[model samples]
Target: MELLSALFLVILTFLVVTAFYHKHLMAEIPPGFIQRKKLCFYHYLLNFGFVLAKTSEKLGLASEIHVIRTIMNTVPPLKDKHLFIKDVRFEKIKVRIYQPKIPTTGQRRGVLYFHGGVGQFGSIRAYERTCCYYARKSDSVIVSVGYRLAPEYPYPTQFEDCLAATIHFMRTAEDYGVDPTRVITCGDSSGGTLAAAVAQAMVNRKDLPKLRAQILIYPFLQAVDFNLPSYQQNKTFPILTREQILLLGLKYLNKDVTLLNVLFEGAHIPEDFQLKYQKWLSPDNIPEEFKPRGYKPGKIIHPLSDELHALTMPTFDPVFSPLIAEDTVIAQLPEAFILTCEFDVLRDDGLLYKKRLEDHGIRVTWCHLEQGFHGIVFLAPLGRIVSFQSGNKGIKQIIDFLKSI
Candidate 1:
């Protein structure tokens, strides 16, 4: 037994050392105010994930990835210092509600927050701290939607769950002392995708209370062109790599993983359809400043595959890619607050969407975190060792915008 234990320790040590070397050497981190502390934390997280996956295999788990995800998803204990927190159901979907304990003269502002995990991970319990912070600091009644994830639930289910919960909350906001008219839809990463889609979906609902604003923090707004400058620049950035981004989409859509390479090369989009989306998603829309980083316009792969396009059809819909929505729909969108990070592949998504919203004559408050990377918002409040200054500043910017509106 002692010999077996030593063998395990040696394997673990080897894995950590190799993973650290890959992260430090192979990772394509962009030039900016990169924080060593945050980088090291991310490096360790990847190493731990690798170790857990191997350990799960030894335990005869069904999936090594699933085992790793399950362990990481163990929710922390609730912190309800300045708020009354409750876990409730909105129709069929589950949601966590946070209402301030302090007395209010009138109905408080409402924020419907969706957490990010590329569609397969993250939950209200996982995002308890972030939601709690927003509710307490903003003094707004916040509902963190625990939408159903993918691989088990399938595509559009996440969107369906978010839309249902938002509708339920909007209809019953008064009962929770929330002013329906002042409500905002907010999210990060893929959650930002849902938040944008939900906000756009709400704009056409005559019966629902109009959302005052929509906040998208480094959202994955389109699938048409993954070869954007940001993708080229930060393809291997920690937390969310370019290949991982497409892999998560395939998982969420219930498609075969082998399709990842095809999708990555832009072969899943036809020539005509690609042209239709190009007007909105083109790199030409990106600002001149963002182009200084290593960015070469990639050639659209020839001989678009019909089967591949058919497999990825839903991704082309405005529901999935809100950035490609028509001008008419965009013009009707509520005021927007967009945050973009320097070292994030999804940076151009936020930048392009910002330009689209402003072009449509919609009010926009933009926050660019020059020193930040993807997943920084969640890292900020996790203590000095794991947190980034940009994450704290980004959250402050969101709160300030919420206050202004």
Candidate 2:
């Protein structure tokens, strides 16, 4: 009885400390955020899980990524009778395929989806319902690519896996009753970065059928300037913060997290490269309406140090920063559907990419969610209690675009 009492006391103390930390986090949520109550609950749960995972990592019971991935992937596979789901490998890459059960008079459109976890911790299992919904609602064959993650697979492997899976799907799409010519590439967050790179890479492929469209949802397009208007406005917003983005990105590249400060300050960018990409990445490319939140041209605090520039050279590669791709490449890409959340740090990336595509004579369908935030669309599949109306609306916009093309 005494031991039980002592254990209970410890647990109570932990809970109190956690609650205090959570309160501090809650204070950072913006005033105009949608569904404040639900957001608070979600944030608390996420924060608690993260704390537990970190504790476990320290105790050597499990790594933090393993614990978080296990928790996120814990949702039981949906037993939806309306769709046929299968887990398969494409060119050694894991992927989940979702197809509607209903018979189709003609070949269905194909969609290759890449799940987002900053190239670290998302899986097809975590996004099961998302792909299922798209397949059923749009009557399309959805392939959710479970690309290899960072630290384990390292940088560019995720991009390579996504590109390989896309090529495999495009080649064998007929076997799955999908229209090869009507294939689309789509992803959110880091996944969006892959989709954009894959589409750009495919532009030069003379063999495979051209992609019908590319959809990027709140994608991180560049590492050039982190002080864009949206970045300033929503840097502290929930789900994803500016510091977290830089830290995760550094980890994804297998670089020292210590470089985050230099990267954030734009010291990792070379003067020559900055000059060449300025026209595409300039804040002036962003429209006036987006600046209403707050934006000031960032003054260069320091020149690029050769050591720092060398460490961040990969960030300038087109495969990593699709926004910096040449105009010739941009013009040859397929029509794009870019989604930007008003309260997302990466919002300007989408807006700038949209403008670049348009300037290059490529068609772009842009969706701006004023009340939405990063990772909102993923919540739509979690049910009414956790999902927001804005997320459902975003999903609807994606479905509508799929059907139109």
- Candidates' C-alpha lDDT: 0.85, 0.89
At residue 284, what lDDT does model 2 achieve? 90
RMSD of 2: 1.7
Instruction: Give the Å shift of residue 344 in candidate 2.
Output: 1.1
Q: TM-score of the candidate numbered 2?
A: 0.95
**Per-residue lDDT of model 2, residues 285-363, tens digit only:** 9988889776777865567677877899988888889999988899999999999998799999999999999998889
Q: Write down the lDDT that model 2 would get.
A: 0.89
How do the residues 1-405 of candidate 1 rate in per-residue lDDT, one tens digit apiece?
A: 999999999999988987777667444554445575557567566657857877878888756557655755674656777899998899988898999999999999999999998788777777888888888888899999989887678878889999999999989999999999988999999999999999888888999878999999999999889999999988877777898889778878778889888777888888888888888888999998999888998888877767777888988888789999888789999999999998899999999999899988999999999888888888665567667888989999998987787
lDDT of model 1 at position 372: 83
Residue 319, candidate 2: alpha-carbon lDDT: 86
Residue 318's lDDT in candidate 2: 86
Each candidate's TM vs. the true structure? Answer: 0.93, 0.95
Segments in model 2 whose C-alpha atoms lie over 4 Å from true places: 1-23
